[model samples]
Target chain A: MSEVATPTQHAALAARVSDACRSAGMVGAPYPGAVAALDTLGYPTTRQERWRYTRVTRLLDVSPTAAAPHTAPPAVVSGLDALRFTFVAGQFVGGDTLDEGANGCFVGPVSVALARYPERLEAWSHSDFATKEWFAALQAAAPQDGVCILVPAGHKLERPVLAHHHMPAGVHVAQPRHLIHIGDNASAEAVLWSDTTAQSEGMMNAAITAAIGDGAHLSLEVVQDEPGTVHHMGHHHFTQGSNSKLTVRTATACAHWLRNDLHILQDGTHADSTFHGCYLPNGQQFVDHHTRIDHAHPDGQSDELYKGLAADKSTAVFNGKIMVHKDAQRIEAYQRNSNLLLGEQAAMYAKPELEIYADDVRCSHGCTTGQFDKEALFYLRSRGMTETAANNLLVQAFLAEVLDGFRPEIRDYVHSVYARRLGWS
Target chain B: MLKIDNLHARIGDTEILKGLSLELGAGEVHAIMGPNGSGKSTLASILAGRDDYEVTEGSITFDGVDLLELDATERAVAGIFLAFQYPVEIPGVSNINFLRTALNSIREQREEAPLSGKDFLAKVKACAQLVELDGKLRDRSVNEGFSGGEKKRNEVFQMAMLEPKLAVLDETDSGLDIDALRIVAHGVNSMRGADRSFLVITHYQRLLDHIVPDFVHVLAGGRIVHSGGKELALELEEKGYDWIVDAQPTEQA
Candidate 1:
């Protein structure tokens, strides 16, 4: 298939997108450069080697109309003792919904942080993926509204900071951006959830740039469950310093189609990174994850495990690569991707690659894609379980290896979501 | 009580059991001893509703219900259990969770309330002890990385938990050490009662020495050529199956 769109169409879409970004107050007001990069990337055609199997042109098919800003809806989540910020139709409506406990951190809006704590925006400018990845750069230049989080040095936030990027009830382009910084010896947890309203239709292209300073610990989770016609394009970039620990989990349960990009750079020695992804897509939905983890210094460690279940003609893709620099001796990197197809039409593609330049480093990658074991199915059924229960048992068990490591609160919530997705609720 | 009449079964056009017939009364245990490829395992599999074997001609009645009409899970709910010779290893399904799910499935069919978590745990611990299964292993995945003996013992452990009306043991004694065999035999013996019937199929008469079936049936070439009491097993063990196979032609004549 040829990606032969007229130049006029590209120029027109770029001009409109750039205008929206400037009107929404892009960080650097560099929409011209973003338009130039978008020209080279050209809307993620399947012709690209990395996107050979993932069909993403359908996401770009929707006409690019700027999402209309609306009044924030009443926040629905409670009981979580975290600073909660909600953006209504890609616009932050100003205050924290949850009761504020003063965690010595900022959670609300990028505009407020840029106006106040300008120091946090410094890390945003140096994102490892923004210049390298087209989607990251586009999101950086075209965010309608977003969240900025900053945890100061030597102080650990006792409460989590939660942000919700809410799209409104109509066809529109939604670009949401987030910048997070954890200073030296600081610790914090954050959650980014994007959901569209009923009858909503559009493309939600979002990006996150996070930096963990020396000796800092951070846990971040990203969840995308949009309603009808909402295609998701997400970019997550992480830069870790010496002795820092960062754990990230991306759980995609519901979406029309999703393409997620994750880039992790271990800039300093002794940094540790863990990436866990669980995707359960059913009934014509698509979920693809492309991740790259780079170990630039000695003693850096990274572990990645991704699990996916495709049912009812759904498709899932996982392409993960871990690279160890020549100087990064003694670094240990491990990656494994496991996929299960529930029906004949359902499909999964898992590709795991390891590039090790250091002779002394330990690195391994494994990819497995298969239907449920027939013997295991028969064994469960022979024990009196109905076919559905047996199938659910096996599916849950296949995913449990990854889910078991999630923190208790996240695990319980994720389990509930998964159960509902399995039609148990 | 269980009865099979004129059973003709085949796997992929190859008949495993040809015109075989057997019966077992309530409160009785029957042992079927046969040489290798004599269809001992096939009979057990057919009784448990394995789909690979096509029952060309047969009538199997279990507890007054037509067993052939039911699927494997339905047969399980109807109180039929088969102990696999090679128990499958399931990595993600925990032993305790699988047992509870299976037990609850059966209970649902019988219109019984599901066992509470506390009660089930108690029952599972007691049953695990019967087969000498380590308490810690119950929390692990079913049969995954278990020793050969442990897999066989796990089968009996699950049997004790399900409490089926009819239990078919197929080569359960295979790959077991003497001590593990003793433990398994003890578990089977503990589950035996007036209402339960068992079909113990083994290549060796040694397992019968422990279970002590009331009747012994010598199967040769897919047919029961001889039937007698427990002494028949010892005689076969001593004289060998060659004597029975050689005498079968003359006995039929």
Candidate 2:
């Protein structure tokens, strides 16, 4: 993609995407609404209020399906001990880490799922998004290779599943879509991480559509630790069933331009949903998270907390909204966004909003932005810690609110991974 | 042993400690009683190497080393501890983690290997017991949402754990009731030894009744105008600081 690409160029790129789908024999099949949406909505511009903090014109010219850079499969992810489905530069590399899903779980490339379980693949291809979710629609229109994970009803996985994405050298763009469905009474946890050793800076516009059945539980963690030169935009949509539980933690460790949109629908009564995130952006890095929770049924509950740590000319944007439909009575929703600015030029924009139509429901939202406590810093330094150590401890303490939301089994592992990524441990 | 000679410190050109001089001997408990804004806290903070105030002209020597040249952590590793007048609340940093980090850092400063987890936990338990601190508080954030009494006790617990050679108590008795004051005083007294010393700074002489300072110094007008033995605390308490502060100008005139 060329920098300073125009919207008209993106409109042409949208046409190229439609033609690519047609020639690839996916014209009538796959998700047509997404292709239609992309054709109608092109891409966002800074003129829009939500796109003020992010700029995508530089990435608008990525030639969809750029050939994968010739490279070896990454071996570093082998120790994750999950059903690993590796994708490099928008193409599926043969899995040496895992061949097949274990114990009533199905994990494989999306094309394989399309060939084997076409009906289920088609069912989850559509997103429940009404607004112009440009990235999600873009991925759907050009998803050449991705992962599909399914946990059949009445089955529980003993291990967490991991889907790792790596972009090899010289690739300009990669658009991969993922589908995860948890059947009734099923439970599983999955972690997705994206990285790059590639030097040719580009973008990755990925999407994941997850559906949870009645009384099922699913926990998902998305870790973005790409080099600061790369751009990333991701969308995750979750639809829940009655009494089901869903928890998601999105951690943006590093990226030059990172934007994530999480849309959750509590469609069934008594469903519980939790959304927690931590974003640390430093030195020209930009991270944004836009989350919306829709309480569509009575007695549904949703809680969200997102914390940002920005330093050294970086910026963090958070907009979390909870909407209670007119018929969705007895809903309980809470949202909070907190930010800590550690550098002189570091900036943060946080908006936590609540819209309730039900009179008797409990709803609250708050946002806070500030620098680290000077008194706390002195207290730590006076106890024999150097300035760096004290700063590390304070940042860790700031992020502890979101870190405590992970499950017990993955809590320590996640914390260590994040700490290492942040150069704190 | 610590010595302060002709110490003069200020913040933003306003003098706080003006040519103040004092000496602390090993095992000696000295109390510096002064009113608010009289530089009581400023003296303790300066001893702890707080950088907000610049020592305009003075020298502070700790154990025959120039304490003025050392940083805050260096001062801490060199065995100077300051119990803050208003303890800070650090959310999400558990007391256990903070204490463990501090203990290991101190050991590293001393060129000693870190202790095993079991040994460290045992030591922490003993120190908590010494200060009558609850074990549950150990897992909670440092001083976050803690009662005033708990925060003060945590300070003493920290003092017991680090076992500093010189303990500077800055208003350790400010918000304490009679009972808390006694417990805190006992915690401090228990750690007193032939090689350990204390410089207790308080606005009231009541704390000296429990800790029983060996020397009482009257700090007024940014100087120690009077020095006496322990009985002097009662005399100052009865007559109040008015007479002493009142006499400074007349004597100078």
Candidate 3:
């Protein structure tokens, strides 16, 4: 791979990428910096260390294009008693009224903020913390509308901020970017969901970045339950400050092909991060997850657990890596990937890697791939449960270990989604 | 009432129960004592409709219905129960949930409405006392992390709840101490009625000392070669199964 490109080709690519940025109304002219970097490094392929197990080029081969802004499609929305922000094709749609307690909170489209507060947009537009993911670069070039959440210092939001991204049919590509900045000692939770009823094959490039200040706590839940005709690519990056806690939980289902990249940077001492992910793929669907946790400072801890259940000719890939730098002594990091294969033709691949430069660090990584236990199935069947009931019960039990860790409302939502996926309801 | 006429069963190609026949009245308890590989447990499994056992010949009727035609659950609903020697442990499903599902399934088969949660809980608590199982154990997963005695007691508790017409104890005494055996026997005995029957299968006669079957049959080479009163169990325990097989007279050619 060479970091060189002709001037003509660079100019053409830069123009197309910049047009997307202008259409989305992103503030600041930081397009050239990202273009130069992409021309140098190019899009990451399967040959890269971090992308060895996940082949993202298959989905990214489609040229970057701007997704047209459209009205939010009607959906069977439940659990809407909390705060809600509806984003249509990366543009913020109208939202319901908020409570008096959320007066200082900032909600709605990112472009609104870019036009309203140019200085804040300039400062937070291009974060240096994002991974060099190709889709992330694409999102940065043509940033669409997304939610911008800001909780002031020492304030606690009683309700979660729910960001809903909707893409209509014929919109082949969407790049939605969300920026969340939490002040010191503030605590909040956010649930991000991407759903589309598009009959055509569309693509979504989503990027979310969160910064946790000192002694703040934030829980991020990302859910992707798009139709099978769509392709989804999501990137999540976060920085945990000193004494702050950040937890990211993701549940993805029903996509022709989907890729998710999560990066957590622990830059402050005594900060903690936890990443949990679950995916269920079926009907020729392919889902891949790649996660990285960087312990940049000493006395930081990170835990990662990603599990998958595949059936009906589906394939899933999980690659989780934890890096403990030389200065990250006394770091406690653990990573695990477990998969359950139901059908004979279904496949799952898992690779958990740990790189520790400090001798006193406690880091462990493990991976497992197998099918349901025959003995357990037989036991349940013998107890008067039908074969279908027995299998569903076991699968529910296996998935509950992960779902139980979520909030009650979110947990129930995930449970209903899983039940529908498993055809148990 | 039950009847097995010239029943033949095999696992793969090798036949285990060859021409085994037995009969039980409604209120009687029959003990089938055999050595290892003598097909005592096979009979219990075959009667309970375990899928692995293939029936090669003959037929069995339970209360005038074809027993062999029913699946495991159907047979269970038809009032046939098997107390597994080594009960399976389901980790996440609570014991109460498992029992209620099983009980309701059987009730549904009989065209009866399922019990309400409060009514079911009361019945379960009563049965739990009969089986001497703790209230805490009932809340845990089905047999998960339970002691050997606790698992057997849970099995008896399930039996008491289902209230089957014919109960098969398949080596239920294999791993029990004297106290567990007594509690398990009491659980079984409390379920006895004029309309219910029992088939006690054991390698040793220790369980028979408590269950006290009306008939004791010596099972040798897959067939019940000798049948006698309750004393037959004591005789076999003292003389061993080899003597029973040796005592069979060879046919004159």
Candidate 4:
């Protein structure tokens, strides 16, 4: 795909893109709507509220580069026991088998779905809400070989599905898309790990859309621990159906600059959602998390808590907004953001907003930014723990409240990754 | 087991304990009763190796080792324990875990094997009963949201577990009621033996009544100017530090 363009340049780029799609024989009968949506909303700039804290222009100012074709796949340790799908850059590499004991569980790359269900592809090829996001736009315009996870109705998978995205070092831009659809009354747990060891500086723009049917339960954990020289932008959309529950735990560490935008829609009555995150940014890294919980129906509940530990001249930002519509009465929503600064040069900005139009709703938000407790540190040190050991224990304890909520396997992986990022064993 | 000779300490440039001297033998319990600004806590802190208090001119020897040369934890491992007047609250670390780590650290310093989990739990349970601390409190974060009496009891509980040779009880009885004080005193009394000593620093003589000191000294103007048998505690309670201060200059002259 060509580089993103300004408004004046957008029209020509869209025309060229449409003609290219037609010439490549990739356009189907339903491609008009998706293409129109992509054309109208090119990319978001600093003007957009959700993209305010993150500077998209700085990331896209450089020339675009694609990932190398044949890099070695990421090394996966055994005993994961979950259905595994590996994606390199934006292309699917391969996968292992799903255990027969997993009870009708299926796992495969997005190419498998593209070959089988051509129509569902046309409907989801573009995102209407995130079309303006520059990375989202680029991801939409680019071709990707991502992952598609489907759980049949009323099927309960014994093991979680593990998807790993490994980006090799280089100044390449990757756009990977993931679509997860859980049928009615189905239950599953999924863990997505994004990692990089490449010495090259690059950016990764990833998008994930999940739809949970009525009475389904989905547990999702996303860990972002890419190289310190890389920039990452991720967008996630979750739609919860009636009487369903969606639990999401996200942890981001060691990115030069990372922006995660999470949007959750409660479409069914009595639906529930939980969003938990922990981010530790050190050195000159910057991490920003923007989350939105939209209570579109009555009798729904949502809770969000995100904690950050920043050190060594790093900066972090957290913006959480919970919206309860007028008709969405009996909605209980709470949001909290807490941060600890390890170094004097480190800083954090947190803003928790509640926009509720319903009279009978219970909504509250709290934000705190401060340093680690000196008394606690002294207490630990006085008990014979070294200063470094005390600080590590305190940081781990602070993050354990969030990490302990993750599935056991993912929790261990996240713990190892965070330990490596913090340079602690 | 512990000796303080002409101990003069200062916080910043202002001297707190000026020329204070005392000696404690093994199995002896000494109570130092004084007024609020008499620097009783300063003596305790100085012995515990608290960094804020600088020993301007003093000599402290514990078990024949120079106490001033050791850091806090080193002092702790050398059998010096100070039940802090105001114990710090450490959040997120359970009390049992903190105690275990502290105990193991000291043991490691001595090149002793660490206590096994089963043995540690039994010891903790036995010590909890001795200090009247509920077993449930062991699972909670260290001293977080603990009541004042509970904090005092927990201090004694730690003292029992560590079994320091020279235990300095710095105002451990200040914030406790009669019942709590009895439990704490009982815990302390149980640990008394020929191989250990106690330095009970307090403002009131009421705590001395329960702990029963071998000797009671009157601390006036940062120095222990009066030393007598346990009767001196009753005398100070009756006469107060004013008479002692008033009579000091004349006695010196």
Candidate 5:
């Protein structure tokens, strides 16, 4: 059994994390609630309901000696025609920086955007999760350089932005905070991809904060393909405006121990949101996805779907909460989660929480956990496919609904990652 | 092409096939008419290498090789096919893709090159036409939401594509209508050749009228008790199975 951390140990670890974040440099001044939130939330404990399945104590051992030298890794999805920005250890390394003076679009790092036009980012750069969640507070208090995408009103960014963050070999903490703001009637697309080297070991506490203005559109795809022994905590928060459309697709193709907290608040009427995610964890790895969407206004719509598989004693957890406010009538919300347990010892936890205060709302949720259909396996085998090929085909079929929502390039890349990790390629 | 001698098998503690024996030569069609629970489907499953049943005692030889040694995939690679009574509905996997994978897998195991796309599609077109299967069914998920007759036609279509040396039709005409039954029987008859053999397991004589067998055997109490030519089906259909079943030797049990 692993030893548990006491209150004093937790305090000491918090102090050490603070020192590490300070050494990694801060992004401008700390946000309004960062200091107070750090003192109040402190460190997350498994005793808390939200942290029950995740053991944050395992991350207390991360102690940094010194930051690794910055070097840009090979670009991912190179053939795709997109503006790419690379960051290593929470610092910008190389990429095309499209910075049109102040009022125009700015596609670069958050630190640069803060230094150049802090007023434009000051309103939406900080998320409410910073005050309510411990990890989010830690990230906001000492945030580092990450992707910053801003599109002015009535303008659409022609090319998608690919923000790639790499964690080099180290025993340090990297808190990279990404921010995006779309003006009224503007639109843009972006991809947040983070990967780590095999030898790297540390903590990646990242946050993505975005705000869509009225009549604006934004679509983002997030990919987490970390292979090293890194513990990742992601706090993603988005707010949609009236008549705005937001679509987010996340593919956790590979991870050791990762938890993603995603929240989207529909702050205006007729705002539409579609979010889908997929994950496959094998061996002794662990993955968790917690998502919530608030239908605060009438005529809003949201659709959520997540599917995954746990193999070889791995554990996966999914929690989705849909909240409808009192006056948010005529809203339709749907949530579904499906999981496959490939190994006898593998575990899966799924919960769907719906709090509908409105009388005229259409809300439904379904969660199912089952193993592969033995009859299907037999049918495939009787047709001459080996066990491996048959299993690969079934897994692909199971995840197609969620994975197909992503762009073709990203979909294939994520599929290859899963196939390689499971040794099905 | 296939031979079974005193094959005893069971599921869990209950014995299903007790000392069952049969033999089939190349270029011949043998129909095994049996009453309910006579282990006809059990024989088909064991021959296809389904692991649900255990062969307690006996030996099965396919083309001079120990058939029991091969797994389900290996059995298919060795030229054996079982048209299921209830074809599985596999969503998200198109029939074309499933057939391509199966065909390539068999070829790979047999040390042969995979069929080219042109040749494979041509074969699919010909085989589908043989069963009157349209392009829509060929491209849809494997038997997903298919009608009863469509599912049976799909089974025959798969048999035509695989072209197995020993084809076992386990109640292929169970849910099929007369026209569908005729189409399926025609698909099966067109594939018969000098190098191929078939084991047709059925209950009624209507299917036999469409695809006449060279010989007929009555399976009762998990063993073959009576044997005759195609005319036996007519006699049995007119007389019913009780005449042959009640006449079996009680000492055999």
Candidate 6:
């Protein structure tokens, strides 16, 4: 009856996970300090403020009894004109693996990239989450295959890359680590999508790490559309150099229970970062998005927006923090989180934390949670729209600001997923 | 085409419409003018099946069908349209897209086919022209950042698109300039036909001057205090409602 996992239990879980990864052919040294961090942080519990709304006690039971098959699922956004790669259960299945040697760009599986050019990826492969968060440490300790994109200095990728990881049907576990390093003045676009079948049931603990060099620009779109009973934990981290720009957009189209911890650090002057995310959890599902951004240098700007809705007894949480370092002057940071409760029993928790030490900085944040506008509903109804149609329109309107930021293909796919789940399609 | 007999309704414990009765035949435009707090807007809300008010004693029959039984959406599908006094501003829903959905929804409910994209666009163009609602406003979010006159004109444009049988103008002329008022009345006059009826609820007689209703009824104390021809609007406009409201019976009071 003790849901709180002890230190011994956490050690046993880690040992079992490493063995499972080794058998699954993930043979590489763990990220530095990951094993020790796992031991120190231990498994997260509701007692911790960071894990207050996200209950990881159920995740303790996620020890996969057997490995899931590595068969490839169907392609997503197939019509999208991009270099596509497919992975199943954190193993590369098929796609165009672009390996352009050490000095050139390389877009392929992380395992392949590690074996091909270890020194090239040595500096940026590790993320802060590996030494800070327990789940992230666990993922790094027993990492699996995910897409790895490395662009050399002053180079722009001609085509975007779509890395798709699918979780097949079984009680399995997959900890995939996607890495991206955009060199100075280099630019690239990529989409990291993970999906599962309705019959699929397991855990997908994933991590995404990116390093944007000076004057580099990297745009990323992340879509998590798992419709099964899987519990997903995502650790997404990004670091930007001087004059670099980073744009990250995430759409949680559907999830059973998901928690996304996104952190970004502007390590140099004049770094610009914009991150926007949206989630709609219905039918007793739960979703949490915890985001933090640090403006460590002067003249840096960051804009963060997270909007979502909880419907039909579902619960959603959003906590955003903005940290401006002591010498990070002339920084402009704005964060806003808005949520809608579509059901009487639905719940939404939103909080914004800002810590500033610089005297000449502008930082502001606002969080709001409310129900559907009755006046808007009545207006639509009076215009001849059915209740369902009106509600669908309202939901679409509420999410358009966030969802519209995604690529058209991804935007339509995510919106359709929401419609199908909500019975609007 | 419409009949309200002894309609007694209230929001919470304060009764707004007490013993209100009225009748309107097909093809007739009836204008109801009264002083402030005379249930002019309340009666319009009740006819459109707003859930904010509870009708304790009433019978609203529209074309021999019980209007009270339908929800607001069903009422719209049943050919009832209410031009809100204050139109709700819905962000992110384009005006054209909203009209299309509404038109298609009403058609689907009436067992008709959906409109084709080409035909729908054509309809939008024609309807948007009726109220002088610009092409830019037609593409923007519904009522978002629209001027007061533009919002009122948009309502008439939607009315033109829906082509409802019973149109209730609930203080539609409250916040409109002279030009916008003429445009709104013109749109309403153009839509009038043998199969369509209108219940124009207003506080000013200026709107009636343009639309020229067939009958003018003064609503006071939630009841029909006076009924006359179109000239009654002129009399009330010149003399004000103090003469009519003061003459109401004391039984309800």
Whichever of 1 and 3 has more DockQ, that candidate is: 1
Over A1-425, each residue of candidate 1 has an lDDT whose tens digit, in order, gives 63645556645555665566565455544545554566665655567778877765454456655546676755534556677888765677756633222446766687676666565576344464455556656665666667777777887878788788877777767677787889899998988878777677877778787889999998988877675778888888898999999999887857778899899999999999999999888888888999999999999888899998888888888999888888999999989998888779998888877788889988888888888888787778788988777877887788887777766566556666666767753
Q: Which stretches of candidate 3 lie over 4 Å from their true place?
A: A1-32, A60-69, A74-77, A97-103, A121-131, A198-200, B105-111, B248-253
Best candidate (score: DockQ): 6
Query: How does chain B score by TM in each prediction?
Result: 0.97, 0.97, 0.97, 0.97, 0.98, 0.98
Q: State in Å the error of residue A357, model 4.
A: 1.2
Which rank order by DockQ, best down to worst?
6, 5, 2, 1, 3, 4
lDDT of 4 at A362: 87
Residue B79 of model 5, lDDT score: 93
* Candidate scoring better on TM-score of 2 and 4: 2
- CAPRI level of candidate 4: acceptable
Report the lDDT of model 4 for residue B166. Answer: 86
TM-score for the first chain in candidate 6 comes to 0.98
> What TM-score does each prediction get for chain A alone?
0.91, 0.89, 0.89, 0.88, 0.97, 0.98
* Clashes in predicted model 6: 0
- Give candidate 2 regions above 4 Å deviation: A1-6, A12-30, A61-66, A70-80, A96-104, A129-131, A198-200, A407-425, B250-253
Candidate 6 docking quality: incorrect, acceptable, medium or high: high
Clashes of each: 0, 0, 1, 3, 0, 0
DockQ for all candidate structures vs. native: 0.72, 0.80, 0.45, 0.36, 0.83, 0.90
**CAPRI rating of model 3:** acceptable
After TM-score superposition, what is the CA distance of residue A18 in candidate 2 from its true location, in Å? 8.0
Candidate 6 wrongly placed segments (more than 4 Å): A1-3
In the range A204-310, model 4's lDDT, one tens digit per residue, is: 77888888889999999898878746778888889889999999999885578899989899988989999999998888889999999999899999989999898
Please identify model 5 stretches exceeding 4 Å from their true place.
A1-5, B251-253
A1-425 per-residue lDDT for model 5 (tens digits): 23456667766666776677777776777666976887777577667777778888888777776876788888898877898999987888988789888889999988888889989987777888999997788888778889999999888999999999999886767889899999999999999999998887888999999999999999999999999888999999999999999999999999999999999999999999999999999999999999999999999999999999999999999999999999999999999999999999999999899999999999999999999999999999999999878887888889999988888999999998988898988
Candidate 1 residue lDDT tens string, B47-154? 877788999897899888999999888989988899999999999888998999999988987889999999998899899999989987898899999999999999
Residue-level lDDT tens digits of model 2 in A235-335: 88999999999999987766778899899998799999999999888778888998999998999888899998888888889988898989889989989
The superposed Cα distance between candidate 1 and the true structure at residue A102, in angstroms, equals 13
Candidate 4 lDDT, B1-253, residue by residue in tens: 7889998889998889889899999999999888888898888878877788888887999889998998777887788888888888876678998888788878887889999999999999999999889878889888889999999999999988888888999999888999999999999999999998999999888898889999988887889988999988899889888887888764252
Docking class of 1: medium
